[model samples]
Target chain A: MMRIVKDIMARRELLVMLVIRNLKIRYKDSSLGFLWTLLGPILMILIYAVFLRILRIEVALPVLVTGIFVWQYLAMCLGDSPNAIIGSTNLVKKAAFPRLMLPLSIVLANFINFLFSMVVVVVYVRVAGEPFGQLALLPVALITQVALCLGVSLILSSLNVFFRDVQHVIGLLSMAWFFVTPVIYDASLINKVSANPDTQFWLNFLFHLNPMTGLLALYRSALIGLPAPALYLVIPSVVISGLVCLAGVTVFMKFQGRFADEL
Target chain B: MNSDIAIQVEGVGKRFRLRHAGTRTLKSVALDMLRPGKRTVRDLWALKDISFSVARGKTLGLIGANGAGKSTLLALLAGTMEATEGRIGMCGTISSLLELGAGFHPDLTGRENVFLAGAIMGLTRNQMKKRFDAIVDFADIGQFIDQPVKHYSSGMYVRLGFAVAVEVDPDILLVDEVLAVGDAVFQRKCLKRMAEFRHQNKTMLIISHDLNTIQSVSDEILFLDHGRILGHGTPESVIGQYESFSRGVTTSDLRREWGTREVVLTGAEFFDDGGRETSKFKWGEALNVRLHYEATKPVGPSVFGFALSDENGRVVNGNNTQIEKVEIPGLQGTGSIVLRLPSLNLASGTYLFSFSAHSADHQVNYHRLDHAFAIGVDAGKRFEGVCYLPCEWRLDREGAKP
Candidate 1:
């Protein structure tokens, strides 16, 4: 890990160039550029709100918008990063450097986009009558989310090099994981559906088993003035995220020598 | 390997598992992992026991057919890939032009890509800032430096790629057929710049089919065949060995037979006046090509031509019996035809000669030999050009001579 950090420091210019390229290619031929970033979260929140209204659920509007924005950033990184190494096969085949940067760059680039979307989140938070007193903890939550995404992205991107089907699997998994993560609903609502013992067990287990549960709870605590997440969610999330990161980096470095040949 | 060698490879080899084509699946990988004995992993060794070293400031020419591990060796030197076995050590910074425009983003302008490529080659942003103008000037793609690289022609792309690579001032440069991409004028300019790089005593490893470039620029050459070094020595001697290896190759199917003529070239050999069979010729040496043909019909105005082609596929010399009107009368039986030249003056390295026989009407080509044999010219004495001409020089009396 230290060696990789050294490589990143030495190759900082290339990383910066890649970041700029990602930005340019994203907005190159578009009109009303960068509005799309805010539009994505807004549209998702609006759709979810309409569904919740039809269902007559009494969820807080501020919590709904916050969940949607934070969740969308995770979804974007999860979907895009699975193919990060495959997408940058150009650099992999021709040059030698730390391979983890390919996915890390994707995470960082989207993190920047997520930061941009925060303006919309701030506006919606104010309009929805959420207090601004919790704003100081937002950076901490954001860092945790970044770390989580980095770990998962590294794993998926490296796996995609070996099994390209991991890309599609991650794509589908991101969509399914979104619904399970309480993005547009509260965990309390699952209590109503917990009639069967199996259903109750899964609902209770999922709320803690999901790493994003802790990350989202942290965000709500920082931005929406929610209670701190349970110790079970926080401890497991950190442990799993750290293990995923270690496993991802180890596998990536082990198989990296074959990337040029395979590509 | 010598102590002064900047790069050394001792029995370096690389074996790649040739994955079944388009067979990337989680199940297959899982099965292979779980049950290793039942799996059949086809592997290809791209390099095998290739031991060589490049003395500091010396250029090594790596030549071979495709898939002979030339690029694999270059990648090893650049640290792009690790050798599966053995050891490779480089004492200083090494950069590779394995594929021009490799890391450039199509959406980036030429100027931006120059910085990107330079950075990938290990130059700092400020160092690139210092040489930006020189790179732009060297690329010579006027007014298009600000345009996206996707808009540039292939030539301009290569120019920009080469320009940035050169400006990095790499301690060792591995060039893989980069000189073959541009136009003739640009090729000359690139070669000139490469010569300047050589003059600066920078170590270089060049892989090229352009044998002339290899001969002129390389101090030593390694001939690779089927992933192993067949021979290695000074360019002149190794090229001779390669030529002779090509000379003794003969196949029955290669012997051509035409319609009722039944004209089959039974045997072909090149020799000098002494009748000694040889493929190596000194500059200005007497040369002869002997062909044995069996004819089943009487044919008139038959033309037998032999042309010499250099490594670039350019025909340097050729002559036909019809062109010289040295035709023999119609013969109904087997006979021999030999073309003799008083002097053969060609540059050192391999020259391919092909022979063909046809009718005067040019409708029928009875027999043709494609690249029948390669001839080697030793860098002995030379006046100029392909053929050396005798000349006399007179000097005014000097105090030392007196």
Candidate 2:
């Protein structure tokens, strides 16, 4: 592990360059350029807002906007993670460096997009007249979200080299995961669903089981004036994310030697 | 792990698992699981028990045919792939040019790619900036440096890549046939630069199928055949073995006997002055090329000739009875033709002999055997150029100085 860390540090410049290169390529041919970073989340938010207003849903727009944008960041990371190593087979075959940089660069590039779309969340909060008291916790929330995304990205990218179906599976899985999380809806809805004695156990168990459920709630609490979740909920989500990140790094390092052949 | 050694390999090997089924998809994977005893997996050793060490300042050339594990060995040395067994030890930084434009992004400008490629080669941003102009000047693509690399010509792409690679000043350089690209002039320039690197006493491991390049640059040569070292020694001996190995492979595929069989060249041999059959000859020594032929039916009026080609399959020189204006009557039985040279003036390298029997009118060929035998020439003295010309040097003094 120490050697891996040192190797990554030695090639940190390459990691940074790869991230910048990916960002440039992502926006190179597009006319809107960096604005395209927010285009997906903005469009999703607009459609969800119009539909919710038409249905007379009383969910807070600021909460939904922040949740949707963060979820978009996660979705893009997960979707692109599988190709991070496989797509760079040319580099993998020719150059020798820490393979961890590939997936980490993808995660960092998506983090940049996530940070860019945070501007939209700020505007929504200002327009909605939400108090900015808890905004100071935004950095912590963003860090945890990025950690969770990176861990998952690492796992998927490494596995995708062996099983190419991981990418396709992730596409469907992310959608289901998004629906289960409180991205467009409120955490209070899951609470209301858990109010029944017959379904309470399973619903609460699933709500706490998903790392993103706690992360999305935390993001809402930070961006809007939503009440913070219970310590038990927050602690388990943070711990699970950390554990997954550790496991992801371990598994990624273990399989990285075979990446060139598999790719 | 001797300090004088730049690289050490101890019984290193790489194995790849070949899957018979396309297990990439979930459906295929499930199907693979259902077929339990189908033998869907097989092991392939891309490299096996390879062991060699390169000194700190020596240039080692690796020569092998395609799929002979040359690239796999290079990748293993570059640390891109790990050996399944044994170990590889290296000292100092290594920069490998396994492919000319391996990490170049087409959307980026040439200048941007230089920095990016340099970084990928383990150069810091500051180091790249310091050497950026030198790399650009070396690449010599002036205006195109600012243009997107996608629009650049392939030559320009390779130039920029080679430029950045050589400028990195790695302690140990690994190159794999990257010099095979670019035009002739650029190739000469790259070779000159590589020579300069060698002069600086940097250790280099190069893989190339071009025998000339390998012979010229390598202080020692390693010939790999089927993932194992077939021969390793001085460039001359190893290259001789490689040539023989290659010829043996193609000889099986060639039509050994053709042409109506009216007259056939039954056998051929080369004898030295002692009249003993020998393929190895010294420079400026007598060599007798004897060809034995047989006539199935009474046929005659034929000319026997042979061509001496260098190792690269370039015909150097040959002579025929018709060309020499020698007349021969019709023959009715087996006979031999002796073409003797009192002094063979070839340089120190391997030469191939090919024999052909043709009619005196030069209309019909009776039998032709190409690359039939290989002869090795060892020049006792250091001689430059392809063939040695016996000459005496003379000097005239214009003014007398005590």
Candidate 3:
């Protein structure tokens, strides 16, 4: 792992260049261009707010909007990472580099989009007289999310070379994983759904098990001035994301030797 | 591990497990993990036990037929894939033009792709920036550098690709059949650039079927056959073996033909004096060439010709209806043309024959087949030079004897 990091560091310029390329290609031939990055989450938040409203669950718009922006990063990374290696077959087969860059570039590109969306959320909340939450906690949440995302992206991109069906599996898994995370709902609602105390404990435990859980809390705490529930879960999220990241790098390097052949 | 060696390989081999189509999917992989069943996977050793060391500042050329593992070996050296067995130790940085523009994204502008390609080759942004103008200038696609590569012509694309590859300027370069693209002028330019690389003391390993290019540029040649090294030595010696190896098996596999479909040469055969079809002949043996053709269009004043050229592509003898005053007024439907040789006077060497039918004015070729047939002449070193002239040596004792 240290060696891989060193290799990436050595090729950091290429990584940055590829990230720019990812963003450039994403906007190519599209008239809307950068607006789409901001528009996508804004639209998703509105739609989800409408759905939650129809379900008669009252939630703050800032909370739901912030969640959507964060979820978009995860969703975008998942969508693109599976095809990252296969899509850059030309680079993977022709040029020699730390191929870990392929997925890293994708995650970085989406992270940039996520960052763009968050700036708008932060400004609108500030302008609308909504208090800024614990902004210091944002970096911790951001780092945790980036690590988790980097891990998942690495694993998916590497595995996709062996099993092409991995692309579709990522799609289904993202949708299923999205509902369990409080991307649209608040974590406090865990009590309303389950009358049984034992069931509520397990439900809360299940939510925290998602590495996104603690990271999402930080985002909410920092963006909307809401107290982060189960904020201590950040420790487990850190550990799990760390393990997932380690596993991801392991799986990636284990199969990366075969990527040229399999691709 | 000699410091003088730029590239070294020892017992290097790549084995591919040829998996069936059904085994590629997730369901099959899951089933495979569950059952651990014995699957019928064939092992294809693309390269095996290959060992060669190229000295610094030297050029090594690879010659082989298709599927001879030349590309696989180059890919291994380029660090595209690992060798399943043995080791390849490369000194200094390496660059490979395995396929020109291999990583070029069409949606990106040529300038962007140039930088991207440079990055892929391990060049930093500032390094690529310093060399960017040189690359674009070498590519010579004026003003197209700002435009996406998809909008560029194929030649422009190749030029940009070749330009970036060489400009990255690694210590060791691996070129694989990339010089064959672009126009003749650009090819000559590329060869000159490669020669300059040699003068700059950059070691190179080039793979090209064009023996002339390889012969002129390579300091040494490595001949491969079916994943194994058959010969490795000076260009003269290894190319000689490769030529004979190819001549012995010049069955339609080596045929190079291109013509309009108005008329086509469907088949060709070589026959000895006894009417036995054979590719081998004595230096003075009578030989006959028969060409079967199918003409889809009616032709007038058609001239059929065949030229016998030596391995160096020098024509020792050529004949045709126009030259022989036997012009056909028309050629319609299927027919055969025979060029009967009373004596094959070429010296002992491998010769290739090309057949063509064209207008009497040599304006248009109804059909032309080029170097489609290879015939070997056996003279037992009886004579020197290309042609076996009808002359005898006389030992007359008229002389200044010391």
Candidate 4:
């Protein structure tokens, strides 16, 4: 583990370049360019606001905007994990460096996008009349999400090299995962589904089981006010995210040696 | 471990698991792994129990046919791939030119990629910053360095790749088969840089199927045949063994012959001093060559030529009737051209010969047979180097041998 860290540290400059490359290439040919980062969340907010107003649903603009931004970061990273190694086939087959950097770069690049989205979320809070008390906790929320996504991205990227079907599987899985994670709806909406107290508690536990459920709640608290997550949900979420990140590192290292052969 | 040795390999081998039935998808591959030693898995050793060591600052060359495990060996040395068995011990920073433009992102500009490439080779941003100007200067892409590499020509891409690696200052460098891409001018530049590497006392291991490159750059050549080391020695003897070993395979099937065929050479024959028709010649022995030609139609101002190429198909010597100022104007019908030589001055080695008959202006080739047959020159006089120039040795100064 220490050796891998040294290898990555030695190649950190390359890591930075790869991150920059991902960001630059993501919007290179698009006319909207980097604005697409801002445009995506703004458009999501506009669409949700218009619909929510018409439907008489009073979901705050900050909640909707922050959810979309944080979800986009994890979604984008997970969506791209299938191609992380396969995408840079030239680099993987030709060059010898820390293979972990490939997926890590994708994770880091999305984190950068997520940071930009945070700025947009802050703006939405001030402009949309949302409370700004927990805004100081933005760093904690962002860091947890990054650790969680890095681990997930690593596992997905390395597995995709061996199982080409992993690409199609990831596409389907991300769609299903998005729907379950409450990107468009709050986790509180589940309360109305069950009438029994015991059933509601079990349902809420299962809902928070999705890593994104806790992360989304955490991001909402930071970007807006009036949503302090339960201690049980937030604590396990942080611990699980850490474990998943460690497992990601372990899984990526396990498969990276055979990447040249598999790719 | 010998401190003077730069690289030492011991019983190194690579065994590739050839899944004959092609279990690529997840379901089948998982099943194969679950059930070990299945019929589908066959072990084919690409390289087996190979061992060799290079002393510090010495350049070693690897020569072999395709699938002789040359690439596998190189990859092992470069650490791009690991050997299934044995160990590779090395004593310095190593740079591999296994593939040029290895890590270059096509969307990135050349300037950005320079730093990126340097970083790929494990250099820091500060090191790359210092070497950036020199690398760009060496690549010589001018303003194109700022443009996306995708727009650059293939040669430009290669130049940037080679240029950045050159600035790396590695203690050892590994070069794959290509030391011969790009135009002639750029090739010479690459060769000059390679020579500079040697002058700086850097150890180099170069693998090339092109015998000319291997023989030229290497101090010693290691020949591999079917994953086994045939021998390692001076370039002369090992290449000789390599040639003789592959002799039974007959290179004629792959011989190249192309021409317009306005006139056709029916046959070509070589003769010795006593008028015996043969291909073998001793150093300083007399040689005679006859070209039998039949012109399909009348041709004007024709030139008959023969070129002698060394083992690498590099022309050692060539001459034609036009160059010698002997012209046959408005030739028609079957005829023979005989060229007589009083003595041969070529160094001892096998050489390939080709005969061509073309128009004097050289636009139209009536008949051109390339790499037709090989001739051997016996090491009669023990003369060294490419040519056996006529000369005598004498001691000019009277000195004491203390």
- DockQ, 0 to 1 scale, candidate 4: 0.50
Taking the tens digit of each residue's C-alpha lDDT, what string does model 2 give over B1-402? 899999999998899988876555666567669997765667899889899999999999999888889999999999888899988999999999999878998899998899899988999999999999999999999989999999988999999999999999999999999999999999999999999999999999999989989999999999998889898899999988887687656444442445656788898788998989877788889999888988877766888788888767778898888888777767568998889889988887777778888778878777888777777788877777777778898676765666
lDDT at B247 for candidate 3?
89
Clashing pairs in 4: none
lDDT of 4 at A256: 80
lDDT leader:
3
Candidate closest to the true structure, highest DockQ: 2
Residues B187-271, candidate 1, lDDT per residue (tens digit)? 9988998899899989999999887889999999998877899989999888656556644333222323343344656667889
Query: What digit string (tens of lDDT, one per residue) describes model 4 on residues B159-195?
Result: 8888988898899998886667777888899889999
Candidate 4: list runs displaced more than 4 Å.
Answer: A47-58, B20-23, B30-41, B251-402
Put down candidate 1 lDDT per residue, A129-199, tens digits, no spaces.
88764566677678778877887887787778778888768767888888888778885666687688778
Cα lDDT of model 4 overall? 0.83
Which candidate model has the greater TM-score, 2 or 3? 2
Model 1 vs truth, CA RMSD: 7.4
After superposition, the stretches of candidate 1 with alpha carbons farther than 4 Å from their true spots are: A133-137, A193-206, B1-3, B27-41, B246-271, B281-402
| Candidate 4 structure quality by residue, lDDT tens digits, A1-263 | 79988988877888998898899889887899989988877787788789879998777656677777888888788888889998988787667788899999999998898787777677767888877767666677778888999999999999888777888888788889888987777779889998999898888888888888888888777667757888787777888898999999999988787777666
> Chain B of model 4: TM-score?
0.65
Model 2 lDDT per residue over A1-263, tens place: 68878989889999999999988888898899988778878888889988988998777777778788888888888888998998899898889888899999999998988887888778878887887647766777788877888899999999999888787788788889988888888887876754676586567656877888888777778878788877777777888888888888999989999988876
Model 1: TM-score for chain B: 0.69
How big is the positional error of residue A15 in model 2, measured in Å on the Cα after superposition? 1.8
